[model samples]
Target: MENNTWSDDQPIVSIQNVHKSFGALEVLKGVSLDVMKGEVICIIGPSGSGKSTLIRCINALNDIQAGSIKVEGLEVHDSKLDQLELRKRVGMVFQQYNLFPHKTALENVMMAPIKVLKQPKDEVEKRARALIEKVRLQGKEDAYPGELSGGQQQRVAIARSLAMNPDVMLFDEVTAALDPETVKEVLVTIKDLAEEGMTCILVTHEMGFAREIADHIYFTDRGVIVEHGPPDTFFDNASDPRTREFLSQIL
Candidate 1:
């Protein structure tokens, strides 16, 4: 299908004929999608459909066998540029809150800016504290990851990604590990980020959140984008049979 029609002005991320393989298993096949600046786009599909792989490739976590991924007009797969710098520009939040077990929330959030970016201690602390407050974890800054609840830990992870001030944020099933009660808090934090116009690409199964917050939704099946459109169009009147069936079961 024509996936490019949904393009708005200039795309912040572009994947063209992308393919990824792990050993003998091929996970992604000729997948192409565009994400506009400041848009919140969610990729939804059945397990092992390459939704996570696609997002990983965007930030160079997974190397694709073929095809090109461009982020902020820079080709990510190109060896000419520094991968570390590329990752700094494209921050990622994982399914499990990957905070250091020994580090407190504040330290977890401050680590990257201080170590990788080499920001001064005072500047790092200032920015990290502000971000902790932004995610509604003002007092929990000193709490170690072991002491925080699942949702609270995930919020810390989000704050950690924001510490880098990335242009694009990639969320790979961020709320999948949370209890239902805790999911809303994390989703609320994400919603606030969306409202603030952070360019985000999320891999999620939360249909309700996708409908309410996503600027666009991409439905993938068997390593291909079966259909893609605005949330109103895709969720309400999905064109492809695979998409329709998937939505029916979830809705």
Candidate 2:
């Protein structure tokens, strides 16, 4: 970082010595990481190991008290940064799916681009249709969230995020609420996105899926990253005993 050569090819996300607290409890303690363009980073650990908090902080869902998080060269921790625009660049899909319950699938996908970005309705619809198809929900656009299965609804949520044309996508336990059979469909769509070289940060418990598509894996614990490396190395021979224990319970 000191060489400054990376300035020409700045990282898509740069988190430096980030720390966050809630009242009396410290959640993130001096955590730091960098994500290069198109990199797929899978964050995994025990339930309370700060996995979800870290990803949420990336897009500013929870503000950090110390250190800095920069996305596409803008410091997120800075008060001057445009949070609304930042979210446009860094999209997030949560475990709850957060789709509009009343709106049909296509409308949920089309609403943001039209209302937030102020794009032409015709143009937004064109792209929304393509995104719906991309998520393998081609024929379900007319269905409401209540009519679709959990997996289908989540896919629509994913498509809604993609409609924003984000530079990076964050997945927070995306398949956690789905039935076992429903999980595969959502995973397949995410795998396709990874293959297409979209910069992604996934906080998930699906060990097999994470091992398959992640370019690098970060194992965090006690508000710090304890281990990080390529899938083969870290999964096979993690540097820490705590990482081994966590993987054993889930894997």
Candidate 3:
């Protein structure tokens, strides 16, 4: 798969023997993974399993203590220029929907494209409006963050990320904080992205969604990936006992 160009070209992102620690706690230990273009890979595990941290490291949100991370052939360690450019290509959606409280939905989506990408103001507004409509928040473009429901706020967050036109999207438990009724709306937005061939790496506990959407499943325990395979193999026939134990509790 690694050699074939059309289907198995160089991975969009690669992490090799990655390690990270905070004081006495070592969060990631020799973790490695590859994310190919247009493939959706889901990471599932218990809290404190380092799933979020692993995703954060890929976009350099969390610095790694050891190992190498490459995004689109550029190494992502100890280089400010490369890291800055790498982040522009990788968009992240967080659990909390970190939209600026002061900005309206439309402005929030336009900020990065205008400031960082140097897009013309008129063009940025046009794209932002289209993205807001795409996420089904058309009439709420002028709504403040406080005015929208959790689902609407999250949809705005997703639109803001998409406004950048990223090559890879990382979703870090994006539905974790939403109400049960609101969760489906966000998940539906994600489902649409998957159907559109977006390359996504998701860290989530929604096993049903993972089963339906993930091309590959990764089981992480204590900061290490114990098993990884196609969803059928990983969910039904995982070789590791730990993977089975985890699935039994959730599935």
Candidate 4:
């Protein structure tokens, strides 16, 4: 199952003993993980368990107070590191669809590449249109954000991220805010991306989806990783009592 596009020896995203705090509330406590190229790693845990905070650290969305994170060998927290370069390599889709309300779906997908990357409009538009179809939203290209359903807007958000040509995609509870009926559509889009050999890190409450898609599953608790393993072992034979307890409640 090796992907020829990326190597397996060196990790693409690395985190070591990371600690993050928001004022007096300490979030991530000595969290550490490594994401290999073309791997889908799912982070599952109770709310406020630092799952979201940890992924945010990988792309420098949240600053770490201690330890280090590196993406493609560049230090994420380095003061001299180029933020735009980091973002271009790592794309993130949030729980909320943050599309510009005034822009059409195609315009939203095309905005960043055209404005930030200075790509030619025609080229960006072409890719944007293709991405729109990739996410199964071909006919809605001209629809405004306000006109689309939550799931459609989220699929558009995924396409917008894809327009940047990111090497790694981070999904932070992307389906959490959608209606029950619409959640499956967003999950299917993500599953398709993972199958296409995208390196993905997901913070999710969807245990079934995690078990189905993840090469490895990480369970976090109390701001630290309680247990991590392949879905088969993690779900049926978790070593940590906390992991078992959490799974019992959820699964």
Candidate 5:
């Protein structure tokens, strides 16, 4: 197991005693994690284990009721923190390829950099083209969403996120919508990013992929992180009964 590069000196994203809820349902309970710079972390658990909520909270997409989240030293839970700036620093990709119907692939990738970031059109276009190519979508830049396959659309969405040039990338079940055959292409693109030292936090169920690529794995259960370790220790020597049961069912 070649555990690759990661910085332990400074954490890029920090989650401390994070607790979130939806009315009576508490989704995340006292979950804590510190993702170092250039680290790749895969979060695995059954549905409704607060994995998605945790990732959302990291990007300040959802507010945490208790505890705090900090991204690149910006306190996410602080009322004074500019969520706009936080989002620019933390890019997130949802499972659904939320591309606009009227916009072509290149347009979809360039829009955010132009409108939101206020980057120059020519500069943004240049960056967008590079991002699209990086995601392996060079040939289909002008194609509409209707023209691309689900996997291709997802790749476009990934390129769209990269266009922002965010410091941390958060993926929430990115390949969940793609058909089994199409899943590999999207996974390959993600793996490439991970290998290139992008600080990434993934909420996914791809156990084998996680084992192969993740520097660390966090197993969440019933709104808590029940077990966590590097891939070797987390995958092969799970200490908790819940972790063992989950691995047995999934693996």
Candidate 6:
């Protein structure tokens, strides 16, 4: 299930005129965007604005009722799409640190590669340890989730996502749950990943971080993208009044 069809010119993730709903409530309406390889796209908006839903759609965690989402040239909602294969290509980190309580940090990172991908234990362990270190948790590998702070647990979660070696990473307000003092560490780790050219799309409230790291920023509101542009222009001279109003409150 390698992605041989994707190319440098093609977007890694493409959402075209996408529409989504939860039972009777429509959450996303005709949204469209494209993320190129190694580009960091930051999505910002008020709560209930479909920021999270849009990213979830990209990974097929939430099915779209209309429009299309393509990742590496494969339709995300296609009937024949391989769920496991799609997950391997598009890694995601959620707001909550969903690490296994019983497993140590290293084991949590190693679990998926061994259980799902069927990689050998020795190889998985080696990579998991490196990933733990990559998230700056080298010494805490043996600690259980309960033994770690929120930031540490979140870093472990990020490392766990990296274990799969995804081509694109979707972050859904990953720092929203962390304490103020601890948020910087988790953000620094993500910043490092983006700088290293891992294609990243994030739904975040950290305006400062988004401004500093994102190649482009999209302001989504009420299920639609009000405006989007390069970080400097978006922050300095927002064209849409809706975007400007949103920025006024948050920034």
Against the true structure, candidate 6 has what lDDT?
A: 0.94
lDDT of 3 by residue, 66-104 (tens): 999887776777565455577788999999999999999
lDDT of model 2, residue 240: 94
Report the C-alpha lDDT of model 1 over 165-212, residue by residue, as the tens digit. Answer: 998999999999999999999999999999999999999999999999
List pairs with backbone clashes in candidate 2: none
The CA lDDT at 246 in model 1 is: 88
Off by over 4 Å in 3: 1-8
Clashing pairs in 6: none
The 0-to-1 C-alpha lDDT of every candidate, in the order given, reads 0.91, 0.92, 0.91, 0.93, 0.90, 0.94
Candidate 6 lowest-lDDT run of ten: 1-10
Question: TM-score of each candidate?
Answer: 0.95, 0.96, 0.95, 0.96, 0.95, 0.98
Instruction: Give me the runs in candidate 6 sitting further than 4 Å from their true place.
Output: 1-4
Two-way TM-score contest, 2 vs 3, winner = 2
Give lDDT tens digits, candidate 2, residues 1-251: 22224342788999999999888889899999999999999999888889899999999999999999988877787787777768888999999999999899999999999999999999999999999999999999899999999999999999999999999999999999999999999999999999998999999999899999999999999899999999999999887999999888877
lDDT of 4 at 39: 94
Leading candidate by lDDT: 6
Give the per-residue lDDT digits (tens) of candidate 4, residues 121-194: 99999999999999999999999999999999999999999999999999999999999999999999999999
- The candidate, 3 or 6, that scores higher on TM-score is 6
Q: Whole-model lDDT, candidate 1?
A: 0.91
lDDT by residue (84-134, candidate 6, tens digit) is: 979999999989988899999999999999999999999999999989889
Pick the winner on lDDT between candidates 3 and 6: 6
